[model samples]
Target chain A: MQPESLEAPTNRPIYSPVIVNNKSAHHLFICEGYPSREFQIFYSSVDDSKKTLLLVSESDSTIDHDSILVTHSELTAKLTQLLGEMPLSTTIYVLGSEAFIWDVHSVATQAGMVAEQIKMFAPVSGQRRLFCTHCYHITEDVTHSPAVCSGCQRNLLVRDHFSRLHAAYVGVQIDAEDPDDLPLPQELI
Target chain B: MSTDQIKVRVAAVAQVAPMIREFTLTAVTGSLYPFSPGSHVVVEMPGEQKIYRNAYSLLSDSHDASAYRIAVRLQDNSRGGSVFMHQQVKEGDELLISPPANLFIPQWNAQKHILLAAGVGITPFMSYLPEMQRRQADFELHYLFRSKQTGAYQLELAEQLGQRFFSYDSDQAQRCNISELLADRPLGTHIYICGPEGLIKDVQSVAEQLGWPDSVIHFEEFAAPKPGKPFTVELKSTGKTVQVGESESLLEALEEAEVAVPNLCRGGVCGQCATPVAEGEIEHRDNYLSVDEKARQDCVMPCVSRAHSDRLVLDI
Candidate 1:
């Protein structure tokens, strides 16, 4: 499918395995939880001398020697300040849940980072965030279809179509054609 | 005439610089089509012997569709097109021009834009100014020219753009530091260069050394096809031969022979007129093909490319 066409969400991030670009002058790694084995493997592929890590977690546990720890609320402010000073030769790696990674992606893009300059790892959780087309409401932590819109309390059919601007899956009224016809919520694979 | 052709009357003309002549063309019939910034139109100049079709960048405000303005610089080695505009064309004369087509638009999502232009190459950037200003885009213009006598619209640009405009006068030994200009730029900044081949190569090499991604750098080159040795091409299907003249392009030769081949821009930059080669050596001069594609030698862009062999057999 052509991503530029108005057909479907073919432009969704594939989250392919990271291959370190050796030419990049700087490497940045942002993790939501404790660094996973995948993150560690990817981080090791980068040059040891020019890497920086930012961990977003609530625990005050001991962290890596050079890593900075920040709470979820501080991720935006911290990322903005860090990205503002970063040069064009920097590559950013984000590892987190689906919602968490996209949230960081939005912030990084707003701070002048192109899609190519940023890399995202596969999401750790199957949960998603949905945006209702009818009420323009956002529903979080959705793991199944036929999710209810928080704002309008309407049953919506969650579609695979994703919007980078909204950073959410599209949701439309499932029973709009017939009021009596309503499909049961099924777990999304 | 093609449906895409627009009839225009020369509303005004001015010798902006020593070798540069600016012409303001108004619609002869109705309102002309609106065009984006950095768009160009191919003007058909009827010379004494033949029609010389030359592409010139639209330099007027894109929002104003009432008139299209273009600046033509007289080539030192006289090409009939620029010479006709310089010596024969005048106000109130009707001319045929192609509808505007753009290939050098600014990246709208860029955090900043840096434009590098030299001499007559600065024409396209003139239309970009009003649009950029309307959007409140952050941009800087770096212009390199010979001197005040030949720098078209240099003073007007400086006055309109103020500190954002930077000029380099070759006569005064002023040079633009490409390395310094590209260094330490923000992550999403885009750079556009429209200058001599040497200037474009210099900036590209410097930008590559600075680790800038290729996506962020853009350029537009419309090198006029130079006269070459005469050659011949044979159609593989019909076994008919067509002779290509020294002054005419292979695409033009094919058109004259009633062999239609799709084409646009007629400059090597656009890849529309690529034709398959069934046999014989090919001379690839287009910017659209990759190095590997050129090395393969299976195809050629007839608009600007020619034959290195005495005769070529085209798959057409």
Candidate 2:
């Protein structure tokens, strides 16, 4: 079934889909995982009135297709053209390891986005799965479990292990009455 | 040119303190890269990292260029750079750094050499101690640290130079008196000092009273006074003008003016702040530039250095 608002899958096999909510003002948010090599393209009406935010793995393939670099130039250009048809403020966040995010900012700057406008972030631990082959789901709790896979588990060495925390939340809106004032989860271990 | 420049990959990283960490970077490009006693490097890391440009003094020995070392102390109350460096950077990570550059080096020929340091200001002095020791140069090192634990590079230094190194804990004991320390130092000695603003000022004045010429005294300052109010800056070449808000710096002002001025050490330590002066006077605030350089009216450090006059025009 098509998700009503947006698809936000957690710690499961089905990779986080390209979530979009156009009910209010045609806002779109894209989230991708590794090994999926996913390609998402959105077509909006000429009169749509909403902002969009794109969040992708820093290790994901670029939209340019010609260059193997992880830059979002092609994605950004496409979104820029799409935004021309709508009235909204769009933001793209390149997610990955700490170094990857830093590189994303550098590349994004070279691509000409105002340094202040670009939002770069990495996922907190447990909230996101760290897979070895981009296809396998290797939980951080595997040491306690007794299952093995033939996938790229050997290559599953952690990247940005220390930099990408499990409990930290990104793009979360905190309210005065909200119980979880802390963005990070209580028990990261 | 010296064949002593190389890019060293990180072999390991050790977190010595909550705010400080040491990196052991092994030279990958070449076998050996020679550096002077007191010098620093420009390090580059991967990604859209915010700590894109930073200068760290080389704490490693100048004799061994096979591997390079640096200690970074994280400043949480920072403008995003140092915090990122502390939290994000790790071991096994590859980084690019320039060959060592130094503003404080011991005069090996001097009959006596005096070294003074405060806090992490002990970095350049750390390298100098060994260099002077190797030369068998007569010198005394006065290490003024807030706390023994907070004093960076203490363990290694104390282990190496047992007697010549003097440790002063300001938190427990009274502040170190320059007059008292200098009065004992034999004449014909050259002094090299690096530390906070207050200590640098007091020592400079005391050294002057001791009849030490400016030529015999060398020091490095890492900070400057906070900008007070907004001021106007005019660019002579581009004919552009901008108001430097209190929240912003003169470098930010020139950047806003769309003027290109080469700069590093945005903090004003690295003479990278040197900017050409055209028609107006500037309030010199940096310690890197000499009096003659300031009098030439050719360049100014826009980062910490500011204009004393109401409206100043820059050559660039």
| Cα RMSD, each candidate | 3.5, 26.1
Q: What is the lDDT of residue A158 in candidate 2?
A: 30
Off by over 4 Å in 1: A1-12, A44-49, A58-62, A70-74, A98-103, A151-157, A172-189, B234-241, B274-280, B295-299, B310-316
Candidate 2 structure quality by residue, lDDT tens digits, B118-197: 77778788678777888888787888876634577667778888887788877688467788877644323567888778
Q: Per-model C-alpha lDDT, please?
A: 0.85, 0.57
Q: Score the docking of each candidate (DockQ).
A: 0.50, 0.00
**Cα lDDT tens digits for candidate 1, A88-120:** 878888888888888988997776566777788
How far is A178's C-alpha from truth in model 1 (Å)?
5.1
lDDT of 2: 0.57
> Mind sharing the TM-score for model 1?
0.87
Candidate 1, B189: how far from true, in Å? Answer: 2.2
Evaluate candidate 1 and give its CAPRI docking class based on DockQ: medium
